[model samples]
Target: MPCRTNEELQNLVEEAKREAPAGKVADYIPALEKANSSDLSAAIFYPDGTCYSAGDIKDQFTLQSISKVISLALALMDRGEEKVFSLVGQEPTGDPFNSIVKLESHSPNKPLNPMINAGALAVTHLIAGVDVTERLERLLCFIQDLTGNHSITYNKDIAESEFETAFLNRALCYFMKQHCVIDEDVEELMNLYTKQCAIEMNSLDLARMGCVLAMDGVDPLNGRQLIPFHIARICKTFMVTCGMYNASGEFAIKVGIPAKSGVSGGVMGAVPGRFGIGIYGPALDEKGNSIAGLKLLDIMSKKYSLSMF
Candidate 1:
């Protein structure tokens, strides 16, 4: 297989956009439902220092569940992996990302993995902070440092909307609390997780962020070590195993790269030693991933032999 030129990659995104309507934009939350379902965008930054973007690359969206990557990494850095894993299991849950049955089934009630809402909430609870404000500030700074973009901020409207309608998540956290998996104030834990999920970014910024992880915590552009190499490795491993919710196994087989997706239609992929890819297609599959974005990655993986497997 040959390396795809930027023009060819952009063309692929355009082609994938046609399938956007096969999925629907998430409407469970009022703010998320406001997204333009037809929109699509993609950006890629290679280790060789080339960057490319196409379509609505300027459009900003929430990180949604994708913020779990940062929260988990920060937890590892602040606390040890042993402690974090004790609270959140590393295995993928075959059930839905937000299922409560899996939590209750385990003796310790550990979340299946940090990518799901249950695990992510636990991970967020573990972030070292005096309060939610301090935790959010640290997490925000970590993201800004990773992307070298200080302008990123949470979408207040989206965060507030999630806060207003997080009854199921509240129930889930209380269950974890019962087992001592999450001891933080239930509302505070939910607020912090919701705010982090509301972090806004565009395709190019996300690609740059993914490039840091792809390069194993070092930014090729600046040669800065933003995260420890081992922690970054752990983060990528989870991305491969559970980043796409239950569809992660299929994604690993087809796209075969380390990637994470959010309900806001953003997919971040790190092709180790190659390039970091970012995609946004507001229409979502039932699993909450970007429909057109996954289609494009599958096509590119086969065409360019990008899969790690």
Candidate 2:
């Protein structure tokens, strides 16, 4: 029910652009450093198959951490809740997404949750595949089905860049392997994980994916169940709890929706039965969320009472 017109959404986007100066593009990944910090776009997809967008909605970006949500759903469908949770905890951590402090401090040595780097690696390990190619294909197929965009594919440049610079992620994989949480080759896992994170799409595709989640795993285009209902619920719960890196609690208080954000400055939001939102602004806050994108969501949440809370 939010942003009934594209003009209304554009107005919100312009207002939110004011916050871009307070943020910076993510430069840790050498490839991501090239993004235009001021670039912002958004799209909203409804269950009725209607969509409205504003700004540079056609521009594409890698999924980065947003892939965690999709991977988690696939992992759940591949491995049941019991097996998956045994390797990753359900609790949210206050630490940064890439921090390794919890793995050392926690008794079980399992990562606190799947949204973090360590836990996501573990979940990715569980993705059903005999080799990296097959696993990556499975994930890609799932994403394609979700968005109804079969052209969705990983950016090879970004994937190679991330694979080359993923020292911290490698460490997480090795540590999890040591604890018996993951038993795959660290390098192979890194290869698949990097490619998973590098999957690319524009705001419209991202919104369509979110709309699938909003509809509890049913494709709004044809009512086909792409994800199981219980699995979708679990993924949404994690989004509410740990989706925006360390800023999730604040995001919940202010935006009050089930959402996930990536370091690529992309946020995917599912407002329960209402609609799905996709936002992209390369300017990132200190917590790695899209600065203007967050503001845009806040404004929309307030103006249209879009918050599920």
Candidate 3:
């Protein structure tokens, strides 16, 4: 079915937009600095192929950190849990997502979890392909299947910008490489990882992808098992434990859904057999999550009794 304009959701969006000014857009990437911090949008996709949306849902944004979930899923599918977890841990960290302290302090020199930058880089290195082109194509194809948007691709400018300034990520790669956690060349891995982060899509597309995870890897519209059920469960588990940077604990208490947020002001929520939600608001809080988007989910979770806890 088609996505219908939702006035109730629109009202929520307007209310959430009020929180935008209180947060700042992610300026570290430089390319993301150009976004309109005042803009907010949302879309909800149900299993029956029905969708509800509010605000400018068509606005596109980079996946940023949210791409971690997808890459983790793909890595699991390619290398299985044993090999993938050997390079990264399953625990959440109290530090920032991009922090390198854990890799230095932790035993065995592995990242804490796949949601963080260090762990995500390790997982991306595991995606099976002969080269960056093949690996990226495989990931893009998987994403295309998930969103059913064949035209979806990475934002070249955003990818270039991130690749150029990813000093911290490069450090993470080298650390992992030195420990033999990831054996690939750092530059090629960085190329793949940045493009993965730069994958672009709108809230509607994001919601649909979330819906697939909500359905436990099945594409609700076509009934295809896009990802293994157990692997999907693993991804959702991480979303609950570590998806929202360091604020995941508070998010669980308030929103209580399997969700991931990107610095581009995008939040993708999977309501597990109920519905999927997508949100975009470029203004980021100190923790790098979309401030307005978090407020929006908190409000919706309470008003609609959406907490899965």
Q: Comparing 2 and 3 by TM-score, which wins?
A: 2
For candidate 1, the TM-score is: 0.97
TM-score, ranked from best to worst: 2, 3, 1
What residue pairs are clashing in model 1? none
- In order, what lDDT does every prediction score? 0.90, 0.94, 0.94
The candidate 3 region of ten consecutive residues with least summed lDDT is 1-10
Ranked by lDDT, the better of candidates 1 and 3 is 3
lDDT of 1 by residue, 15-43 (tens): 89988989899888789998888898998
TM-score of every candidate: 0.97, 0.99, 0.98
Off by over 4 Å in 1: 1-6
Model 2: residues >4 Å from true position, as ranges?
none
Cα displacement (Å) at residue 286, model 2: 0.7
